[model samples]
Target: MLIKSSKQVSRWRTPKRFPVSRNSGASPASRIEPGVSWPEPEGATRVQRFKVYRHDPESGKNPRIDTYAIDRDKCGPMLLDALIKIKNEIDPTLTFRRSCREGVCGSCAMNIDGTNWLACIRSLDEISEPSTVYPLNNMDVIKDLVGDQTHVLAQYQSITPWLRSKTPAPAGHERLQSPEERKRLDGDYECILCFCCTAGCPSHWWNGDRFLGPAILLQAHRWLVDSRDEATGERLDELEDPFKLYRCHTILNCTRTCPKGLNPGKKIAEIKLMIQQRRS
Candidate 1:
């Protein structure tokens, strides 16, 4: 190929650049300085402030709290709705788990304003001040609002929550229980394994290595009290260790913070009572 001279190369034209509009579809309020209150959008009547914890291990920076201003009138009444609005409209990088926007899934469980709760069920009106949101306490945070629940789930699995009977069920029939016997499972059976109670317990915070936290212990009690189960003795044997069962000091934090409002403290006490009766 023939080489172009300096005059020929200098005459070549470059592509034209267009000026971008300052007021584009993107919201300028999204890039506002941290800790500053975001301005209310046009036609928005109410603005709710939220301070959420943010962390990314790969960023090699210290964790921080991010402030977000949500238009209350445009969003749903629940805290989870505000979170979703932030993730979708304001900051796409915001991360949190949510499903079944109702309370049944327990996926949106987090610490809000110093209490562990399911965000989907918690009304935004309940928070009088600027709400603070965080991941569940005493658990490793995987990212913004997502916590690592591997240990808590492992402890739950150790309890053998399914029915265990020495004798198999009758051919082609499931195990049956009387209505009175079924009533025994009312408080215990409702647990959704959210681990909110476990994360809230001081005993688990201190002795999580060995102690089965309130959630797992409550699940253990569920199996122990099952009318169709025949492994009470074996289950009790597994939970007899001092750290495994007796570490609970009855601070009632578990009971106070359970999002489901089930009494895990009472269930743990019942387990202790059963063990005491067996020994006596």
Candidate 2:
């Protein structure tokens, strides 16, 4: 090659080869042992300690943190697994609620690493070290991780989530709903009632008594958008109250925190339109 200018000689050169794998180029499956962690040389430690919050109401004591150590390499990185190890081996008295162990049951809802999440679905790797778990904020704490959901249940009942059509269906026939109508309620109907949206709403903090919040509004959308329902006008009337509809500040917290990817804000907008159109 011919010699180049000074500027060309000063140019940086990129590396031609990447670093080799540390594990002798072995595939991950070949190295991994089922039900047992891969060897980590001699005297390797794989324990992670979590700073879990604890509170007892009957004793009238303050909330506190209790450290729990769990073997990270043995089980998956799910927070629920850590909790189970803590409960079984570390502290049997530690209190928390979980069911189904899947994301379907909302019983494991709590603040993990300062955000409301279902412990069953939240991986330990996503959380910061020394993670803090607490009962959901703005709700009554029944114990350590359990919340008194009587208020959320009351609001759910206030909106009347079930169908209430003025016309009853014939005994032998079903209420026919077209595919178009079914598609209308798709996004709004997937709510798992995890209460993450409700806990994040500022309107809930101020006027939970009158404002139904996003969960109820989404449930209302499920009914109002259904073509088979004859009580759309009546449901609109109930939602016409300013506090019930306008109290939502469009903060978008409900949509952001929804575990099932439902948009409560969008459903509330539809409710607003139904109320306005019916009045006119």
Highest-TM-score candidate: 1
- For residues 136-209, write the lDDT of model 2, one tens digit per residue: 75676677788788988887887677877778787898987888888887987778888878877879867887
Please give the range of 10 consecutive residues that has the lowest summed lDDT in model 2.
Answer: 5-14
lDDT tens string, model 1, 1-280? 2323211111212221126442233333212123334454566678788888877667755456788888888999999999999888888888999998888888998988766888898888876447788889777778878999999998888888788899978898888899999999999988998878888887887889899999999999999999999999999999999899999999887777776778999999999999999988
- In Å, residue 278's CA in model 1 sits off its true spot by 0.9
TM-score of each: 0.84, 0.79
lDDT score, candidate 2, position 278: 65
Best by lDDT: 1
lDDT of each: 0.81, 0.72
TM-score: model 1 vs. ground truth: 0.84
Which residue pairs of candidate 1 clash? none
Q: Count the backbone clashes (under 3 Å) in each candidate.
A: 0, 0
